[model samples]
Target chain A: MYEQLDQSIQQLMWDVRKRTLKRMQSAYDVAMKTSYKDLVTTVDKENERFIDDHLRKLDPNAKIVSEEGLGDKVTDLKGPVFIVDPIDGTMNFVMQHRNFAIMIAFFVDGQPVYGYIMDVIEGTLYHGGPGKGVYCNDQRLHAPADNDLHDSLVVLNSGITLNGGHNFREIGLQARGVRMYGSAGIEMIAVITGRVGGYLSYLHPWDLAAGMAMAKELGLSVKAIDEKELDVLSSNLVLVATQQVSRDISELIN
Target chain B: MYEQLDQSIQQLMWDVRKRTLKRMQSAYDVAMKTSYKDLVTTVDKENERFIDDHLRKLDPNAKIVSEEGLGDKVTDLKGPVFIVDPIDGTMNFVMQHRNFAIMIAFFVDGQPVYGYIMDVIEGTLYHGGPGKGVYCNDQRLHAPADNDLHDSLVVLNSGITLNGGHNFREIGLQARGVRMYGSAGIEMIAVITGRVGGYLSYLHPWDLAAGMAMAKELGLSVKAIDEKELDVLSSNLVLVATQQVSRDISELIN
Candidate 1:
């Protein structure tokens, strides 16, 4: 564990979180990044800038990969790198003003060192790493029971499930129940907290980075849906689940 | 308006909310009511008893129709009635210990007087009716902009949507996005808060009553998917949404 780096990162997150709450109480300008579903708010940009400045100071040599284009192009994670999503669920941020999260992951020489997924509204910080163990605030979390696919709830991207992407509709049926919370960070919170058996979504690097680290640290299966290696800088259809559930999903889809 | 009833109910809800939070801090027994999808926990039972006893003292003359069988089995809403769901999302309550709610609705001569839908974890209480107007805690709510179905998100029952029940899949596809949160109370929270344009689910009386009351008061459409008048005492495919969204869903389904 990078003890000093971890502490610095956690402190930065809490500081950023306070500003985010105050910033959210007022209005912010919003613009579509790609589609109406893809939004970028002034708050998102401000938060990214705030975090980027702090991250730069925390690890001067580390390259920062960020969603809002304020950081490096980050073609690879060959060295110390920080991947950040200032607001992981912008649509939910625009519509509900809740369920959005700030996610950050740190990697050293291509190995995850630590990750943070903060539920902004609830002020809950889920942070830790493989050797350090995962935590919800000060509470250490055990690896959730690996329940069978048919016996546990799953979180699916609603669009994919409705459109039958990767036979997600069938996968939804196989689970004990299905939920769609819109925010990947919130969905990942469900997964890491053992609220759901797993999550399946097509996500960008910034969206998947923090969640993937936490899932991996928790000893959950974190993999590409297509059974290929996940390029740390590229988007993919990802599955973060228990071993048994992951196998069930892969078999059903393939 | 039963002004006295309204004040008493709100106070009772706050009291119950405190007790519920305290009760949840300890472990509770969980049992399946019918299937794995259906769960009843000791918290549900204890919460129901607490609320029932309070309701009995608050409105000695009114009938209580509740989910846990702590209520009357009257066939119709013929007089002053209090419809309650001690815990609206028992499955969510069991699995996540959050995203559940305590819901209650009051009707006199089959006309809604007021309703309460409290998001248990968030401690947000949405309570109001037609003449009194709706309030989320101390802030009064205006009718949310009735955006077109294609522009607004729709919340669906994951099971029903995947199974194409009531042509919900098609309806889901037509919306900008779809989300499923599992609990009727939580889903209703999305609707009444104007976070989503609409919500559709197969619901029991207790599940639908409080949400329906709040939605109606907010000037949204609260109706049966079949375009039939709701019975207020029977299970049905319920649609609670902005007027435009409701019409769009009905058109898409038909």
Candidate 2:
């Protein structure tokens, strides 16, 4: 039922990728947010504006929620909403010149309907939601086999791992190893592809929305560590992984 | 004087890349070493043998030291010594199927003469030593600006960071951010390219040899964290970074 919408969103994401990649090649301006570690750039603002314009034109009544303040002031996802993080991992983009992504999710009546996460430099897109199977580009992705937490490789955020919050250090010890790529979209995609068994991080709405939307469809479980359903408008300590691994992490963290 | 030898090693590395990339596409055998977190594969051994054979043929009198147990046992870095980690980041190779590298170093009279670290999947090679400047693929890499420890992004090993050894936790807290890519070769390349300012971890002779050689050519300091000269034949806690940042890390850790 949402095929056309998914395709349209996917096409728009590619266009965003093209524009973002071009901007990455040239020099750009950067501004700090919250702390020195948190970053935003001119490319981020420009990409948000571009996606917002395209999404508004695609569905005039849809509410757009984005990172760079170019979208509607979104309080709740009660109606059609496009949640966007125009440049996820801006720190990576500004510093590493790679490993960043563009993310978007379309929700209707507070239900995730379509999601997209594009690793811009690598040109790989992880997209889908609900009945549509998840995909990395043209290839369909199956639900990953449920590996136990002890047997899995995990992507961890640097702060949480060091802080020892949520018993994360114990979890790190049990896991095969931990990788830190500093991009939520790429980390989620790693789980979807079975490259890593799980990923855990604290994230804002735009950062978590799109990846989580697709994560669920791939037969992975994504949730707030507090055991409540994720609230679309609020930040959450999120974990996405195979069902068994997610359960294992929840037990440890909780 | 080493131009011919350097060119030959570079050509051999490309050949290794081709063989390894093709093998990565197919199934291969993996064996655990020390622990499940440590892995070795048939492909690793095969690549090592391949490189060893070529190196022997290129300079028949040179003594070879390799990770895969295919090279001679040498007590010291006397005469012509070739150190090879045919596949650094073997865990990455087995788990992520990427981020692994082919690292090689050539030393004569215990002096580093040439070094090569090939990020096989990305097809970017970081190679050179001493009088020759470092190059990432074809582009010459200049010495990275001596950013302070607080101003830099650092790549750290997951085990060491969480273990809180070498004052690593303090370093992580102080840096702009910390990253863990699981490949020392790629991490060192990140330093040479200025994508990251420093990398530190415990490493074996094969793992440390190549990258340290290239690092010195880029005007980066590579040293034993204990403020002693490295024992080339034994594992050492190592740090590779810009001069000032290395000193800063040294002071903090010491």
Against the hidden reference, what TM-scores do the models get? 0.95, 0.97
Cα lDDT tens digits, model 1, B169-212, are 88888887888888898899898888999998889988888888
The iRMS of the candidates, in order, is: 1.2, 1.0
What is the DockQ score, from 0 to 1, of model 1? 0.75
Question: What DockQ, on C-alphas, does every prediction get?
Answer: 0.75, 0.75
Off by over 4 Å in 1: none
Candidate 1 TM-score, C-alpha based: 0.95
RMSD of each predicted structure: 1.8, 1.4
True lDDT of residue A208, candidate 1: 83
Model 1: per-residue Cα lDDT over A100-122, one tens digit each: 99999998887888889999988
Q: After superposition, how far is residue B235 of candidate 1 from its true place, in Å?
A: 1.0
